[model samples]
Target: MTDQSPSEIALESRQAKAARLFSPSAARNRDAIGDLLAGLLPPSARVLEIGSGTGEHAVSVCQRRPDIGWQPSDPDAVSRASQNAWAAEMAPNMRPSLDLDLTRPGWDAGLGGFDALVCLNVIHIAPWAVAEAIAAASRTLIAGDDSLVYLYGPYLEGAATAPSNLDFDRSLKSRNAQWGVRARSDVEALFAAAGWAAPDRHEMPANNLSLVFRRRSPL
Candidate 1:
């Protein structure tokens, strides 16, 4: 495969910015996400954020945590373009957007490594394969046990599901058979297979959760 020249990628970014988008959920939750990230990320951590819709959180968090280098990525061209624009306008420690599709082969190639990987509100919106791909990529992109994988989204945990979350899950499934909120236990087991310990879950606003999973040492 041919690597794109910087000029080419920039041109695409300009064109795609016309497709710039906004998400109510991102606007509503960005501050909360930032608050959590401020506490979780170590000084000078290099972070890679997946599914960075509209790049809102990236701009918000990176501005506050200039100590961290943040790389934001999205599979969608529109989102990627918008991310570039956002970074250009108000980047503190934000890098240009990356073209990453977790489910695609070679997606994580050439990514040196990261101190932490963050994915917000993505899994339930995508197929199960994407979640599997996240774990698979961790082996190469995240180096050691102290590194973390942070996931934030709605999940089914404990014995009972909240009514609102159940409704949201039904709505997601209706939109696409492959998509719906996932079970926490199921997600934990999947990551364990990829050498991560069970996540420490934090309650967030709107019944969502922030799951912090530490990478397990490679044997």
Candidate 2:
């Protein structure tokens, strides 16, 4: 056994705390999201997840689906740090987080050929252009007929928006004018423009929705 200095012990404690950052929403929705993904994704699939916030979802989902390889990414340095720390603790299937910004051009340049792409609670908090870019990139990266693009967040469905969702959308817009719940039809149109088929929407907990879009067969 090696002796440790007090400074070393303090540093170790701080590092440990930083590694285990918590997100209440992630904890609450991870199981529901995992169940949906398990049904949609194939065994041994390669999945790339965008906006992998606290990295909690990456660890949880990867652990639940050990056969699926997971790549978690975020644009924020702090988020990447948290994801890297979580990946270090999780199974080998979880890769270290990558630096990804949906707003940037060529964001998916080197990251292609994925079996699936997942973005949770992202679009509602980002500019509409981000959603368009994501759809465009998904079309380019996912090559297989069976590949999927999975998106999860609140959405406006014509005049059927829930009261809670309306409040949430208002709060989001107050934070950033560009950020708010997107219209489902508009989102579908984005995918359609990218040569993707119409999405299948599933109702999730807390008025959130899970949209699964598939690529159309080449003519």
Candidate 3:
């Protein structure tokens, strides 16, 4: 095959853009997260991802891990549209996007049971109550001890993870009175109260940590 001319390449690029739903963060860390999931997630797992945002991660993860089925949800219409558009190219394992808001009731019933749950970049951007609601929703959706929930994003300990995150947290608060970076201990307590425990924590690049929580089996 010969190399395509500039006009042909540009037309192909435009065609690809027409085919897409939307664009989001193409951080190298997405694959890193996928690597973590490869080791942590079981084969043939059913994963419900909350706040799928651009749906890029959802599509990539599902494509990379054909064994796992993914359900991507977001409260925003544009996000869902983007997710739907991106998912058009993926396998059937990628489920339809749902309008899921962690703050609301009845989401658990709607979502039903899942083997695992993954949420990225939500806790730090949402309110404290929203974070609690996520834990509660996880408890309701998981049926066994082996069920896992992975949260990825920036977190703060007594010491700041990075000056940039600290500044980002402050800016978030300034922009929205309800949004701010959450502390790891506080999040841990929320998980514990919701009958989940953390067995491992993976520190990612760019001051973000991937925290995995396991739901306690029903007594």
Candidate 4:
């Protein structure tokens, strides 16, 4: 095929810009997530956000906390492309989106340590192994004693499962046998084995939970 003309490239850019994905859930929860992060992250902290779909949370957080250095990443090409578009309007503190896939081997090879890791609405949709991989990788990725790993998603916690959550879990499992709401206890244990302290669970809107895990000192 011949190289596209400048007008063609410009048209495609406009189309891609118009195609940036927007999640209703993100629209509803971004402020809550941003408020939490504003308090959680230290000034000038380097935060790596995984599964940054649509980049709304990243932009919101960056706008709220200019002191932070935000790096957003995703595994899907479509999501990453969308991130690029959304991230454009963010402050200079926001880095270009990285195409990082935690499930892949050597996911953190070139990347150095971060002050914190943030992942929202990702775990339950992915296979269980993704959680294990992130837990394992986080151990090495954040070395400071107070380094944090923030994960947000629906979960089966102490109280009886909310009807909405139960139905959502069922729907997930129906679509993908490997996908379903995870037991909080199971996730706690998995992270414990990876040397993280028990997460401090924060109840969120829509029956979701924000689990904040702190890094532990090496033995």
Error of 1 at 164 (Å): 1.1
lDDT on C-alpha atoms for all candidate structures? 0.81, 0.81, 0.75, 0.80
Q: What digit string (tens of lDDT, one per residue) describes model 1 on residues 64-183?
A: 898889999987777888888788877758898898877666788789678888998888888888899888777778775578889999999766777889998899888788889999
Q: Write the per-residue lDDT of candidate 4 for residues 1-219, one digit (tens) a residue.
A: 224321100011122356476777888899999999788887678999888888889988888988888888987777777777777755577788897766666667788678998989887887787788788778777767777889998998657778888898899888788788998899899898988888888989999889999866566
Candidate 2 whole-model C-alpha lDDT, 0 to 1? 0.81
- TM-score between candidate 1 and the true structure: 0.87
Ranking by TM-score: 2, 4, 1, 3
lDDT of 4 at 57: 90
lDDT of 1 at 53: 78
| Ten-residue region with minimum lDDT total, candidate 1 | 6-15
Residue pairs clashing, model 1: none
Task: Report the C-alpha lDDT of model 2 over 170-218, residue by residue, as the tens digit.
Answer: 9988877888899999999988898888998899999999999987777
Cα deviation at 85, candidate 3, in Å, is 1.9
Where does candidate 2 have its weakest 10-residue lDDT segment? 5-14
What is the Cα-based lDDT of residue 139 in candidate 4? 74
| Candidate 2 positional error at 217, Å | 4.5
> Tens digits of per-residue lDDT for model 3 on 1-219?
224321100000112254354443434566888778767777788898988877777877877888888989887766677678888776567788898776655556656678888898887777676788888877778666577989998888777468878898898888677788888888888898988865468888788889998866567
